[model samples]
Target: MGLVTIAGMAESGDIPMREPLAYFLTWTTYGTWLPGDQRGWVEKPGRFREPNRNMEVANREQMTEPEFVLTSPQRALVELTIRDHCKFRQWSMHAVNCRTNHVHVVVTATGYSPDDVMKQFKSWCTRRLKEHASKPEAPARGPTKNPANSLPLTLRQKFWTRGGSKRIIFDQEGMENAITYTLDGQ
Candidate 1:
């Protein structure tokens, strides 16, 4: 009906696959809530009350590198990329903040799912990051005899995790709260 405000949070590799904090999911008619969760969380559908040690170990084992932390320049690049994408798409971005480990954005785009918006932002930001990383100090005069000496064609490092938190804002109060959190809560 009116402008819909969405809060999207994306984490870096710092957070394990399974966390102690409670996470929620909503279905068509109902939602799942898990309490006092341990290793059997995947079997359940909703909120996990406590930490799962086994899951945490498995997640740690899967780590390819140390926790991915964004530097100040990288964070600034991310913010710029997001703002450019929003402007090109004609979406109203109320606030956006990029931290060392995560990013929070408050935006409104009519007829677009929050998940889709988040994905778009993540995709563009990743491209920008890769471009920055692969840039050469000086332009290449010709193709390199040894391909190994050339810049990498693909990005080996990851900037964002698979999925992120998406919340819908239904009222003015919700929009205000989301903006406040994005701007000040960090």
Candidate 2:
């Protein structure tokens, strides 16, 4: 693959959100574990030849039932939400993929920290999801609670972890890697 030169750079604190930012995000439902090996909702082979253990074969629902992994619909929703929210927030998206276990976003943050950008994105998406899910005639399933809800009222936590893993793309090689990693499954 060749160099993926975005409109701007994915810099650290000094960088802005409007330029270029590549953020790969993975937020779960409460304490729900993702597609790896937490709940075993989607059975896998004990060994390499134990059975068909193709990761691509698994669906998002199977991944999110026990966790809040991105479903196909959710992925589409995320893409649309990203476009709409970015336009509203004046951000730019280089590339975005809603994986089975997490969300990979390659964007441009012209004037915001990765953390702030992610927070804004997550908050906006969450609100949009909540609003889209609410209806007068139908019962709102809404967001699900993790098993951790057994804790006290003050202990009850919200969805998504506190922070995310962000990196700065210094050169074309790194940028290509970031883009490929964001697109192709690991």
lDDT of 2 by residue, 1-186 (tens): 222233233334334333333453434343344343334432321212222334334533443223344445545766688778778877667667765445667666666667777787777666655554454432223442323223321222343544444555545555566677777845
**Poorly placed runs, candidate 1 (over 4 Å):** 1-46, 137-154
Kindly provide the TM-score of model 1 when superposed on the true structure, using C-alpha atoms.
0.65
Off by over 4 Å in 2: 1-29, 34-70, 136-157
- Which one wins on lDDT? 1
Q: Please report how far candidate 2 places residue 93 from its true position, in Å.
A: 0.6
| Count of clashes, each model | 1, 14
Q: What is residue 142's positional error in candidate 1, in angstroms? A: 21
Q: Candidate 2 local accuracy as lDDT?
A: 0.50
* Model 1 pairs in collision: 34-47
Each model's lDDT comes to: 0.55, 0.50
